[model samples]
Structures are given as C-alpha cells and as structure tokens.
Target: MSNPYAPPDPASRPPKQREHTGPDAPSPADGGPGPGKAPGRQGRAGRPERPKPTPEQLASVSRSVLHFGLFMLAAVLTMQVDLPWHLMSLAFAIGAVVVGVRALVRVFKEQIRGGIVVLLVFGLMLSGMLVVTTLGSLAVWNEQMERQECLRSAITVSAQDRCERIYQEAIEDRFGTIPGG
Candidate 1:
C-alpha cells in the first residue's frame, strides 16, 4: 500500500541548500544579496534613481501662472491709472501672445500628449483674454476720448464768447457807439 502523494524515490531527494559564489552577490558584512549597492556606500554612490519633474515641466507650470497673474494685475491696475486703456489692453494682448508662443515651444520640447492638451487649453484661454481686454480697453478709450472732445468744444465755445465781447467793446470805442450785430 503506497501513498499516492509520496515521492517515487525518497532516497533520491535533492539537497536543500545551495551556495552563492557570484561577484554580484552581497558580502557577509552587508547581509545577504539584495537590490542596489551595500548600505554604507549608498550615499557616496550618489542618490538612487528617482522620478523628478523635468525642466520643461517646471517651466510649463511657472510660466502659465506668471502670464495669468500678470494679465489679471494689468487689468486691475489699468482701471486706477489715467493711462489710455487701449495701451493697457495692447500690453495684455502682447503678453498673451508671448505666453502662447512659450506654451507651444514647451509642448514641442516635452513631447507629452497631456502637457500639449493643457497648453492648448491655456492658449485658448489666453487668446480669449487678449480679445476681451483689447475690446474693453477700446471701449474705455472711446468713451474717454468723447469726453475730452466734449470738454474741448466747451472750452472753444467759451473762448469764442469772450473774443466776441472784446471785439464789440473795441468797435464801440472806435465808433463812439455800441456795435450792432
């Protein structure tokens, strides 16, 4: 009666232990073999490989924030100063153009599909901002210009009135009577 699960020849069983004698294997001083170099020399060997953000990635984030912030700040400040809104809006548009170009360059350099999508979206947003700022500034400038024109007209009318009174007085003195209109 033999057990079904038993080995056919128990006397022929292989040895349980195997010896490691490779140069890559860990020395006795550093415990058994493992991934990477020995513990004490790990620091001197430089840091282990790690995933890190590339320069393009860092530039992408930094530039995006900077352009956006600059646009907003310019928009707000334009309202407080007496400078022409058209000029402020033009500056904003130029800034957006610069950001768009930078984004395009980064997309090409990084060659990342996701990054490209993000940059494109940002470009669209910046473009829209440019348009809005430009239009808004134009409107403000037109309004201010109209007001200035109105003030100039008023000043001209007043100056004409004063000149007419002086001319009447000079004519009366020359003729020894009031000048008739």
Candidate 2:
C-alpha cells in the first residue's frame, strides 16, 4: 500500500481537467495567460513582471536599516557603563536619529512604501534613548571630570586611590546608600 503521507505519483494520475471550456480559455500546452492576467503581463519566464525600485526608495530603505543597526549598537554600548563609551553611545544614538529622519523624509517625498514604519518606530525609540543617556551623562559629568583630573595629575598610586575615594563619596552622597545596607 502507498504511504498516506507521501506525494502521489504524477505519472499514474489522470490529466488535469480545465475548469473553463470556452474558446478564450487558456491553452494548457503553451501555459497561456490565466484568468485576470493579460498577455502583455508575462515576462521572460511566464511570471508577472515586478516593478523595479527607484534609487530614492533604495536610499531610504538603506538609511532606515542603518538607523536600526545604529540604535541597537547604541543600546549595547550604553550598557558598558564606561563614561567614554556612554558618550560614544550618545553619539551613535544621535547619528541613528539623523539617519532615521532622513529616511522618513525620503520615504515621504518619494512615496516609498517599505521603510516608513521602521523609520518612525526606531526614530522615537532612539530619541528617548538619546535623552535618557544625555541626562545620565550630565548627572555624572562633574564627578567624572574631577576623578579624571585627579588621576591625571597623580604620580603615585595613593593619589589615584584618593581620586577613587572622592568619586565614591560623591556618588554615595548624591544617590544614597543601598536600601538594605
């Protein structure tokens, strides 16, 4: 017995019956145009021809994709917890926003349909991240600067220790101790 899940053998099957019998019905031999398809719609392989995208649409899509990648990179960078890297993350977020806006504008002007939703969503998300990072960076700015200056002038390990102590004190003073401690 044949396996129930296996495909049927084409050679043993009867020929397909055409649904339409009129004179205008598509010919099976030549794979003539089907219903709703005009003769001119077929391309080289009898498939419908698709319209090519314009250069503007290509640019818009590329920019939108780039912004998405940049935004993700910024989010990862922000988690590094280093001041310089946080600044770099801020820069990446800013660049993402700029690229996203350009993509949105191009998509709107050219009437491209593909990347508008991506641009809008990532643009808003990147903006919120940018503001949050900027504020966080500002809050730590003075402490970081003082620590850096202190460490820069230190010729010995003890002075560097002093800089770290000051930074810790400033942070604890501003943020208070851990709840359980």
Candidate 3:
C-alpha cells in the first residue's frame, strides 16, 4: 500500500512551464532571467525600496561642516592673540551655535552621526568660551585694581575697604578658589 502523502513521480506529471499572464510576469524582451524570479533577488522578497536623501539634507550637511570649520578657525585666532579682542571669540561662539543648529536639522534628515559630532564640538567650544571670557575679565579687573591704588590712599578707610572687597569678589568670580584658600 502506498502512503497518501507520497510525492508524485516525475514521469506521472507534465514538465513545468512559465506563465506570463499576470502582474508578476517577467519582462523577457528586456533580457531578464525569467518569470517571478529576477537575478537581483538575493534573498526573501528582495530588499525594501529606500528613499534617497533629499537635496535639503545634503545642503544642511555641507552648511554644518563649513560652519564647524569656521568655528575652529575663529577659536584658534581668539586663543593665541595678545590682546583680548573678544570679537573673535564672539564670532567663534556664533559659529558654534550656527553649526549646532544646522546639524540638529540634519539629524532629522537621516544624518545622525554627523549631527552628533557637530553638537559635541559646539558644546566643547562653548565651555572653552566660558573659561576664556572669565580669564579675560579677571585681567581687565586686575588692571583697574592697580590703577585705583591712588584712590585707596586718598579715600576713607571704609571706602578703601569697599574697593578691596570688590576686587576680592571679582577674583573669586573668575577663579572659584584654591582647594583650601
């Protein structure tokens, strides 16, 4: 007795044939492989169609890169100068903000890694700006303190003490304090 689920012998069935009558029909005239299966299908159901990046994405990426480079250049110029011309530092700060914002826009446009780099760099630059600005203010206040010595000699004790307190507070504001002192 034969099993009910036994496979049919090849001799008992006709040869298989390709059908070209439906939506999955092959374009044989274009030299494709055959019906239903194309040569490009490497695995299950072919790769999903991905939307290409828009021109806006490309522009944002380029804009952010340019502004980030500008920020770096401005940072070097500001840090190495003899005089504390804060204009350059301010420009660097502005550049950092611009680059970071542009990068954020790009992040929504499928450029995650690039956007993150821009944001991190901007954060570093802003932190450096805080330190540098504080140092510059300290220098300016120190000069005023030196110039005000003539007033200290002429003023009342109370006025002199007030002036001294102002200088002390300025120093503390710039550099918090030594560990113990």
Candidate 4:
C-alpha cells in the first residue's frame, strides 16, 4: 500500500504566491509590496508626497482668526461705550475662570506649554476687556452725573424766579403799588 502518512509532493503542490494584486498589495515597509515593485523598495520612493494644509484646514484657520479679530474689535468698541465697572469686572472674572479651566484641561492632556500660552493670552484678553468696559462705564456715569447736575441747577433757578415773581405780586397788591403808571 502507498505511504498514507507521507507529505504531499512539492511538484504537485500549488505555487507560493499572494492572493491579491495592485493597490491591494501591502506597503513594502509594512508588508508585501505587490503591484509596482519589490516589497523592500515600495514605500521608500516613487509615491507623491501629500499636499499640506488642506482647503478645509485653511478655511477653518481663517474663520478662527476672523472671529478672534472681531471679538477684539468689539472689546475695543466697548471701551468707548458706557459699561459698568462692576459688571465688566464680573465678566472678566468669568472669562478668566473659563480660560483657566480650559488650560487645566489642556495640561491634564499633557499639553503643558500650550496650556500656559493659552492661559497667558486669555488672561491678557480678559484684562483688556475689563479695563475697556470699566473705562466706558465710568465715562457714562460721569456724563449722566453732569447732566443731572445741570438739570438740578436749572430747576433751582426756575423755582427761584417764580418765587421772586410771586413775592413781587404780593407786595404790589398789599401796598397798591401801581404808582409807575
């Protein structure tokens, strides 16, 4: 009887080869490099480098910058307007708290230097906003006070004039003072 336990003959066995081809081939450095070249040199050359800064990324950056610039401009305009000092301070404090929290989160994520830079920038922005708002509020308050004082003075003068006229009429009626006619 034939040897039942013997291994199959090499000539009769299927050729050793990968099942797939083309782009399906693994990269040279990682695995079998098929379609184009030998596995050793496939990833080393011939492939075009990827383009930098995709359009979406560029647009995102532009939008972020525009938003930041607008925010800064608004803050500057607020400085010229009448904002309350206490309210401004409160808003700045809130902003600072938010920035601190974000920075802490970044730090926890192993971005310590980035967190510090962000914290510094946010702190500066908050401070600037507070100052602008505070100054605006003070200016508005002063203007209101001046207007009130002017109104008060005008009322006082009018009241005094009316009092003088009434007193004159009473004297004329009491003493029959039509002598000038």
Q: What is the C-alpha RMSD of each candidate to the true structure, in Å?
A: 19.7, 12.2, 15.5, 20.6
Which candidate order results from sorting by TM-score in descending order?
2, 3, 1, 4
Mind sharing the TM-score for model 1? Answer: 0.36
| Candidate 4: stretches off by over 4 Å | 1-51, 84-181
Q: Which candidate has the highest TM-score of all?
A: 2
Clashing pairs in 1: none
lDDT of each: 0.58, 0.70, 0.60, 0.51
* Predicted candidate 4 versus true structure: per-residue lDDT over 3-83, tens digit per residue: 979987878976675545566556545555545454444333656333355566555544543444444444445444333
Ranking by lDDT: 2, 3, 1, 4
Residue range 49-104, candidate 3, lDDT tens digits: 34556777767676776676677667666755433464466567666666666565
Models 1 onward score TM values of 0.36, 0.44, 0.41, 0.28
lDDT of 2 by residue, 1-181 (tens): 7798988787897666455647876664567666644555566666666666788678767767666666757766674665665676666667766766666676666655655566576666867677686768679888977787788898899988998999889888988976774
Q: Is candidate 1 or candidate 3 better by TM-score?
A: 3
Identify the superior model by lDDT, candidate 3 or candidate 4.
Answer: 3
Per-residue lDDT of model 1, residues 120-154, tens digit only:
66665765676676665455554445444455555
Off by over 4 Å in 1: 1-61, 76-86, 113-116, 119-123, 132-142, 147-181
Return the top candidate by lDDT: 2
Q: Between candidates 3 and 4, which one is better according to TM-score?
A: 3
